[model samples]
Target: MRLEFVENGPIRLEGGRFRVRVGEREEVLEKPRLSLCRCGASANKPFCDGTHKRIGFQAPGGVLEVEGD
Candidate 1:
């Protein structure tokens, strides 16, 4: 299982437990691969609906600093 932040795109979660809850709703993934929204433009919350491209969303930095195992 791994989380990879693509170069200026959504974070991809592969072969991992993809569980997310926002308010009263929750998302459950049945696939081994999933792209999570980071640009905050996805119509599907917690999931990438490809809205970032239309909105031209950009992360301030190109690097992601993660500290966990």
Candidate 2:
């Protein structure tokens, strides 16, 4: 599994087994790829609808690493 925090855009996930849960509902992602919203402007919460581009959302994007992994 790999995750990419796109430059000034959504978070991209690929080649992973994952699940999404909201309240009492849960869904196992059927697709290997997904774009999750990082900017709070997306109408589709938790998913990217390309709203960041329209709203001029800015964020530092890159891979995050933990020490002593």
Candidate 3:
């Protein structure tokens, strides 16, 4: 499984259950496709609760820029 950030929107998850550590807690998901919140306003915590759509999130078009080469 792999996780990819979708510009300004959410983190896209592909494949099966992957482990993630948050603070001291570990989270495992069973879904193959999921959108994770990045704006820190999601009521659902790790998952996107459609707050981005309500807040009018404008994700960058098809390009990702990583800092510091």
**Reference-based lDDT, each prediction:** 0.75, 0.85, 0.74
Which 10 consecutive positions of candidate 3 have the poorest summed lDDT?
60-69
lDDT of 3 by residue, 35-64 (tens): 879778899878788788778777673434
lDDT of 1 at 68: 62
Clash pairs, model 3 backbone: none
| Candidate 1 structure quality by residue, lDDT tens digits, 1-69 | 667777667887776466777999887767888888989878886889888788887764343445568
| Two-way TM-score contest, 2 vs 3, winner | 2
Model 3 spans with C-alpha error above 4 angstroms: 1-8, 63-69
After the best TM-score superposition of candidate 2, give how far the Cα of residue 29 lies from its true spot, in angstroms. 1.5
Number of residue pairs clashing in candidate 1, backbone atoms closer than 3 angstroms, sequence gap of 3 or more or interchain? 0
lDDT of 2 by residue, 1-69 (tens): 667899999998885576999789888877878899999989988899999999999998887433444
Query: Model 1: runs farther than 4 Å from truth?
Result: 60-69
Can you give the TM-score per candidate against the true fold?
Answer: 0.69, 0.80, 0.63
lDDT-best of 1 and 3: 1
The clash number for model 2 is 0
